[model samples]
Target chain A: MALRDEVQVGSKDPSGFGVHRKRFVYFALIGLFVVQSGLTYTTSTEVPDSAATLSEQARHGEALYREFNCTACHQFYGLGGYMGPDLTNVISAEGKGPAYAKVFILYGTGRMPAMGVSEEQADALVAFLGAVSATGTYPVRNMDLTVWGTYREMHTDEK
Target chain B: MKSEWTAAKGFVVAGLIALLSGALFGVIGSWQHVIPGVVDAIPFVKSRPLHVSLVIAWIFLTAVGGVYHYLPKIVGAPLHSTRLAWLHLAIFIGTGIAVVVSYFMGRFGGREYWEFPPVLGIPIVASWLLLIYNFFRTANKHKGPWPAYLWMWGTGIVFFLITYTEANLYLFPHFTGNMVRELTVQWKAYGALTGSWNLLVYGTAMVVMERSTGNTAIARSKTAFLLFGLGFTNLLFGWAHHIYPVPSALWIRVLAYGVSMTEWIILARMIRQWRGTLEEGKRGQGSMTGRFLFASEAWVFINLGLALLISIPAINLFTHGTHITVAHAMGSTIGINTTILFASVFFISSAPITKNLRVGFWLFNGSLLVFWLCLVGAGMVKGYYTVLSDLPFQSIMLRARPFIVGFAVSGVGLFIGLWMLTWAGVRTLLRTPGDPAELDIHSAFLVEGPGSPAPENGHAVRQGSTTTLQP
Candidate 1:
């Protein structure tokens, strides 16, 4: 095929600045995505003991979590549903612990229907949550803002 | 048209089927939220994934199908290999069947959007490779400078495979063993995956617009590519906004917040051009595509505004994990993407503006608006009570019940409207012959060439007159 007869990229612009600029922007953005992904992976801090090998019981509770779709109402790290409160630090938070979570799961609350999970399942669920709580906190409410637009807790051990 | 184009049509049919099935499950899932014991056969757990997966399938299948159908036409060549396209379709349909079966059998292991067994992901990756090979081979033939839509499609196709693979990385223990890394990687993949597909869908919208208006300058203009660049950039870095509440590094959240705010450029552009677009819509009253393009513009305004508001860390404090988040998702997926795809489907099928379709269009949009508002209502109640008052989850939900009921009821209307549109699309796809003359599909609706007279309505219509197409 004779190439000159065809519309080449930037053909619409006699100056060709638009085409060059766009290509520059596109490649630059792709590079940014790669860099961000790398930084996120390398710098991310896991919950304490979150990387520890999971116990068999905790694994069972994990399965129960998905099977019942607890995520439909509850969130971890503030990512799931809004109907329920975040469970990220619930097990470790003041005035709430595994025992507090267990009662609601096994017997249900006034508003939340009983999940009908067995007693053993409830224990496993609490164990799974305990493991998650060991990972991190939620709501990121400590608004220690830096000049660079980040919370102080994100970079420091202020919490 | 080549027989290869028929394969593209097959994907549309498959996508529509998935759309209806997904909507059915969506309705079931919503009602289940209200009446818990209503559908015991398939509980909310099963129904939610089925809804999410199938709808996601519809977007991919149709957007990719549009790419397949248009790529050769735009490139002025036949597809590199028809057999490969069919192979891609076959593999995808096979994978879909397996996914549904797995869901029904209560087998799930992957992350949120991809709740099916992890093993099924293999075929998906393989099928995508076939598409990549076929796409580049054909698209490379275009002689002129590649248009914005071409770049959009290329970026979308290549990045979808990349991000999708990234999403499944959790199957590796290294990623899964750490909660922070796991959550970060999961959402990283999801946000990009969504952006990749949006590029594809938005590319289709651009092509449809260029062809309809016969405006070569539109796609080649500096502003268009600039917008594409901005969108691409946001896709790369803005995803972390979805996870600000996660105790990830501060840099990720800061970078995403900046990236997300850039969308105001697009919103401003839309506002600047609003008058011209409204005039265009008035002139295009006779064209369903014109109407749809206008509708998409309005949705982009509303959705982008909401998106920008929620992207802020301060506002996100209340909105994260709330129904407001769902509202944002719905606004983008249904309000924006669905309308754009509908326009493309009508353009390709040459379906007419009939009374029934008009009713369906109004019903879908009207119901969706209400549905969106009800979600915002529910989220406001929940976000306030949960954040400020420390109410129990059930207590907040109890207060939000009326809105929830409204959402569920309106969902039924949305489904019915979508069904009517889908049925009409199916008929058009089945009946329309492969017209080789229609290879230059983009220009089919152009009414602005030299010596071309506008219709008596003083507007450009589709290539074939209204009388040529069935209502």
Candidate 2:
């Protein structure tokens, strides 16, 4: 239970990860993790619109999304299955909007199976997609790459 | 007969069942992808989560069970508490049932990969806490400086609690409010969560090697410790590679790429070690555990290379969200993790490796090889067109259907192989502990355990069932 006992109990033997060094490495890594997690939870979150939060309708839509397990096939930020296109910016993409997304939700495409959503449910899903698109882009085709293999726009506040 | 070893065997049996059923669901899910509207009763949506959760259960159950069985021997002490261990198992299985029922009833509200009701997480988390307490208390009794595996297990036990809880952060309004934050945090949790389990699994692998070969120095070696340190570092930082395409901060993505490159070191070490294992491996034919361990080494070589390439941003731009990711995931979970677990399972049983077991081994690996390649081929095609061209998803998927069908057909072989293995694992675990074949493991006594030769360890000396020899 004691930190000393936990870190240095068996460490009575010398050489190779012992005493002071082991304790130092362990605590330092834990400290770094804490710092990284904090920074990630707070300052690191960058989105196009600071004001674009999920609405009540979108929240219900998110629940519906989970209930139907759309993530099993579709993607958000290209982080889901390969069966469907990335829905991150689908609502705002040219030639695709609320109606287009709604149709697909209501009656599935040839490859994409229908989720059996009603019209009201379709409207909510479109709202969820709209809010998601407002947050940021995916398949970000622009290539202002840094020499160190990072996208240039990720660090900027620019839209 | 207060045989605590029975509790450990129980976990192994449960794990094997989970694995067999999970692989069955996986086979169904694969076929469903190729031909839609099949298995309408348990659709792809339901089957996918069932497969994922059950396979995950298999990993956790067997790995934790290994710890329970082996720790007392390593420490030369009685386990801190058998009651708590049983309690942990009870809660876990109960939660698992609830999860299954919820998914069947279409009552899910959790994130991807963990789509069960959020409330079920409470018992799961509670059980993990019992494991953490029980692990530290027993492991703290270890004599001398702890081995690399011990450090690995301890870190894994603690972090599973941390990251599993972190996974639930979406319950808060803040995390769920914005898409960018939700995606970033979700993946961050998932990445480290995987690392947590990897520690448990890799630790068990080291223990199995040490016990099988009677090489105590393996776990205590500088090389082993160095590898653990590298793995730990990567678990902490390498996770961001998953989100390179997402609009997270540049540092997050760049750090992931840097950390992921560390696997090159791991690969080089494993290859060097494999040369040494080559002759020993030829003699390992009748040894089911030995065969599985060797297979895992080969898998690690394959997967680690695939993982490293995809971690690169240049290539990741093409591969990030494709079947390539699925391939990597499958390669790790099946090729590496599952093989390691099979080795552990067969090791615990000390079961005589049979002709049938050998058949299953080849069948599983052979099918998995085809399964892995099909995913890679499909990924390569889809990633190319999806990124370089503006082809719709339907068109691209059509191009990839041949591979999906290949993947589905191979999955049947994979399932048959798993069924054969599960039969062997369960049969051996259910055998009378005092059977002649069982005593060879402890009689070898390179390390402390069930039939530990040391008379000072009162519990194992009395418990003759754990004396099963390492075949």
Candidate 3:
């Protein structure tokens, strides 16, 4: 076969003459933009409503905490594993707000390894954890955090 | 003839390595269950790396050998650099040995498939670069716009380098942050190296098929090229499934699915076309390599099914980051790539076989059949219990013990096949009766009835009295 014919058969012309190729590229770009915007919007808006009493930043922080599998280790309100200390009264003990918790997470102390979570993720985790600390009810459903909520409730009642 | 010699040496080395490793893996795999708590031993972890590395080494050596033999014939020229080829051989063997040593010492970089520490990794990378440089430089001096087979091989080499670079990033000082992205990249790299390299081998197969059959129709070549291109695209983009749990946008997921589906479509089309082309008598030929090649095509579909199953958004939600993915990977690599590599070896070795060659053919095919069934069956059982059940990881490991045993059992068949191939390759190197000229003449006579004047394009062009076939 001729080289020109071979090229034509193998690849769609890049000159935007082909209607299907042009459409595909346009659609892909549009779809990418939409997904990026949607994720950003969901991250920003969905936080405050789920835990309405908490600050907007705190709500976003909560979303990050859930997404990153934090609860797999540290306990909160009798939830999570015993691998790390309970953060139920962490804010009160630190004598500060969510910022102290964020700092601790950012630069982990003693046996706690720094998880290398991004700054944004750290802030969101702090806000969410702070909200949980304030309410004393682990924000389980909002993040789909998969904590044994029933077990936590039983332990909380016992306490 | 020189190309044939090089291929023979490669076959011997690769075959020996494969047989030894297969035996070791089989023994270790069987013992892991029989001996209590042996799975937890440091040696077990070390052995896994050794198994994977040896498999990689054997396949690569075979691929290089096949390419060296076939490229010269395909391009109508002798090899550009026999010295560079020897260098390639040395680098592979030396680095492979270093990797095995490093693994046993617990100095591995600790990544699936990329376990070889940087000490060995650097040399391997250098060897690959040298190969790419040599191949491309030689290819540039040739006349034709790159043939599909050459393109495939070239692309495989280039992508192998890219994959290695991405893999090595994990060893870098600043390798912290974006765990999901890093993991995705790692899997993508693995997929490309294996998938693209498989395509390259398949391309080589296409060339051999054309040479063997004297059927270089544009349609068949185009179909092969398209399948390879589409397969490459799918293999690279389909890695998005690995990062499903990460905070990546949905577009990534969509891209992964779209590309992967396209890959399957092209492959399906190619297999359909190849099946359609198979003549009646050709189908029953006792060429062990031919049967294995046909079986490998079947495996391509099997791999496609597993790929699509895991690619499904709903299924992937559960299967992602699970042992099922590992099964899929093994199925594709061992089931598809290694099978094709062996087929290529069989094709090359056909040039010089003196004995019936059919014995080797049957042994190899039978071994592969056993290997495929045992591995697939074992993988399915392991995937189901490990992924679906809420059992502890250790309990799941216990459930997988039998499958591990199955793999070991299957390795026996693979060892037999490797030995047969080595024997056949050695015979070919010795200018045995079944070499290229003899097979070509026999096939030509089959094509054009006895007493008919052999056409110029027919296999008679290479016929010489000295090339004997003792039957």
Q: Of the candidates shown, which would achieve the greatest lDDT relative to the real structure?
A: 2
Report the C-alpha lDDT of model 3 over B257-307, residue by residue, as the tens digit. Answer: 666666566455545555343442254144545455556666666777777
Which candidate has the top score in TM-score? 2
- Model 3 has a DockQ score of 0.04
Instruction: Please provide, for model 2 over B1-471, each residue's C-alpha lDDT reduced to its tens digit, 9 standing for 90 to 100.
Output: 134576677777888888988998999899888888788888877888999999999999999888887777667666789888889888988898898899889788888989997889999989988988888898877767887789899999898889989999988988777767778889999999999999999999888766665445556555666788888988888899899877776678767888899889877766666655564455445477767877887888898989988887877877888888998999899998999999888877877767888789999999999999999999998888876677877789899999999999999999999888889989978874721243365333333443233221100111111222233
TM-score of each: 0.89, 0.91, 0.66
Q: Give the poorly placed runs of model 3, Cα more than 4 Å off.
A: A1-159, B1-8, B19-23, B30-42, B218-220, B246-249, B267-281, B284-286, B318-323, B351-389, B397-407, B423-471
What is the RMSD, in Å, between candidate 3 and the native fold over all Cα? 11.8
lDDT of 1 by residue, B1-471 (tens): 456778888888898899999999999988987886568788666788899999999999888888887777667688899899999999999999999998888787766878887789999999999999999999888766787788999999999999999998876776666667778888988999999999999999887665565444456555666777788888888898888877666677778899999999888777776666676666556666777777887888899999999887777777887889999998988898888888878777777778888888889899999999999999888777766665666778899999999999999999999988898888877888773332133233443431232232111222221111101
DockQ of each: 0.32, 0.34, 0.04
Candidate closer to the true structure by lDDT (higher is better), 1 or 3: 1
Worst 10 residues of 2 chain B by lDDT: B456-465
Quote the B-chain TM-score, candidate 3: 0.81
The structural similarity of chain B in model 1 to the true chain B, as TM-score, is: 0.93
Worst 10 residues of 1 chain B by lDDT: B462-471
> In model 2, what is the error at residue B360, expressed in angstroms?
0.4
